[model samples]
Target: MSLKWVDVQEIAIQLVDSRPGVDPRFVNFVDLHQWVLALPEFNDDPRHGGEKVLEAIQAAWIEEAD
Candidate 1:
C-alpha cells in the first residue's frame, strides 16, 4: 500500500522495520523527512510532508520504537 503524510502510524512502523538500530528520539526533522520519502511504500508528494507532519511521524516512530 502507498503511504501519505497522514499515514503516520504506518510510516513509523515502516521506519522501525527499515532502520532497525536507529533511535527515533534522536532523529532530526530533515533526516526524518528524507527517510519517509525513501520508504518503498511511500508514494506522496514530497512537498506535502511539512513540519507538522514530520513531527507526527517522528512521534509515532518513537512510540513504535518503544
Candidate 2:
C-alpha cells in the first residue's frame, strides 16, 4: 500500500520494520524525513512534510518501537 506523510501509523510501522534496531526517539527530523521518503511504499509529495508531520511520525515510530 502507498503511504503518505499523513499516514503516520503506516509510516511508523514501515520505519520500525526497515530499521529494526534503530530508536525512533533519537532520530532527527532531517534523517526521519529522508528515511520516510526512502520507504518503498511512501509516495507522498516531499514538500508536504513539515515539523508537525515529522513529530507525529516520530511519536508513532517510538510507540511502535516499544
Candidate 3:
C-alpha cells in the first residue's frame, strides 16, 4: 500500500530520532545526504534524489527534485 503523508512525516521523524543505518540526528540534511550518498544508487550520483531524503527514498520517490 502507498504510505500516507502522515506515514512519510513519521518516517522522517524516525530518521531524525533513530539511525536509519548509521546514527541518529541525521544532524544536517547534509548528513542525511551523506547517508544517501553511501547507498548504491545515490553513490552513483550524490544528486540521485536531488535534495531531500523524502524525495530520495519516497517509496521510490523525494520531497524536492532540486
Q: Residue by residue across 1-66, what tens digits does model 1's lDDT show?
A: 889999999999999999999999999999999999999999999999999999999999999999
lDDT of 2 by residue, 1-66 (tens): 889888999999999999998989999999999999999999989999999999999999999988
Instruction: Superpose all Cα atoms of candidate 1 onto the true structure and report the RMSD in Å to 1 decimal.
Output: 0.6
- lDDT, candidate 3, 1-66, per-residue tens: 333323435444444434434433234456555644444322243454354444534433223211
TM-score per candidate, in order? 0.96, 0.96, 0.31
Task: Estimate candidate 3's alpha-carbon lDDT, on a 0 to 1 scale.
Answer: 0.41
For all candidates, the clash counts are 0, 0, 4
Q: Which scores greater on TM-score, model 2 or model 3? A: 2
Higher lDDT: candidate 1 or 3? 1
Name the lDDT of candidate 2: 0.94
Looking at model 3, report the run of 10 residues with the lowest lDDT sum: 57-66
User: What TM-score should be assigned to candidate 2?
Assistant: 0.96
Q: Which regions of candidate 3 fall more than 4 Å away from where they truly are? A: 1-27, 40-43, 52-66
- Which segments of candidate 1 are over 4 A away from where they belong? none
